[model samples]
Target: MNITSHHGDDQVRIALTGELDMATTEQLRAHLDHTLISRPRLVLVDLDGVTFCDSTGISALVAARTAAAAAGSHLQVVNAHGITAKTMQITGVLEFLTTPPGH
Candidate 1:
């Protein structure tokens, strides 16, 4: 997987592409750690480009959400479609990470 990040004000937006699985989870976590050092007010993960995600990816996302909450920031997942959206719903993690309409 590839992760590209952009920052504005107190928010950080991360665009993820490719597959997120066991092999890529660590890389994603590392990126999240680096981004959190800036103490962003919000972290938005754009998953529109992500083609696949396994359980490991889901765990990483949950961990990111927990970290953001602990830092008094918000975490959101954006532009998720197809199986990714379905997996998030089936796993119940979407309730915590979903972006609001119009975001």
Candidate 2:
């Protein structure tokens, strides 16, 4: 997976591409671990380019959100569709991570 992040308005927007599986989950985990240290107000994970997602990937998202909340930051997943969205839905992760900002 290719993970890139941008910082703006006291938030970090992380963009992800490629497959999100066990092979690439560590990279995301490490990236998120590093980002959470700064305690940004918002941490957005954009899965616009992600072509696939597995259980491990879903777990990482949950863990990241948990860590972010513990760090006093808000974490949300956005732009997830296609197979990735289907996988998240199948695993019941869509409800956990895909909530919009206000609701």
Q: What's the residue-level lDDT of 65 in candidate 2? A: 93
Residue pairs clashing in model 1 are none
Candidate 2: regions farther than 4 A off? none
RMSD of 1: 2.4
- Cα error of candidate 2 at position 59, Å: 0.5
Residue 79 error for model 2, in Å?
0.4
Go through the candidates in order and give each one's C-alpha lDDT.
0.88, 0.93
Taking all chains together, each candidate's TM-score versus the true structure is: 0.92, 0.95
Q: Total clashes, candidate 1? A: 0
User: Tens digits of per-residue lDDT for model 1 on 1-103?
Assistant: 8899999999999999999889999999999988888788989999999998888999999999889878877788898888888888899987677864235
Highest lDDT among the candidates is held by which one?
A: 2
- The TM-score leader among the candidates is 2
lDDT of 2 by residue, 1-103 (tens): 8999999988999999999999999999999999999999999999999999999999999999999989999899999999899889988889789885567
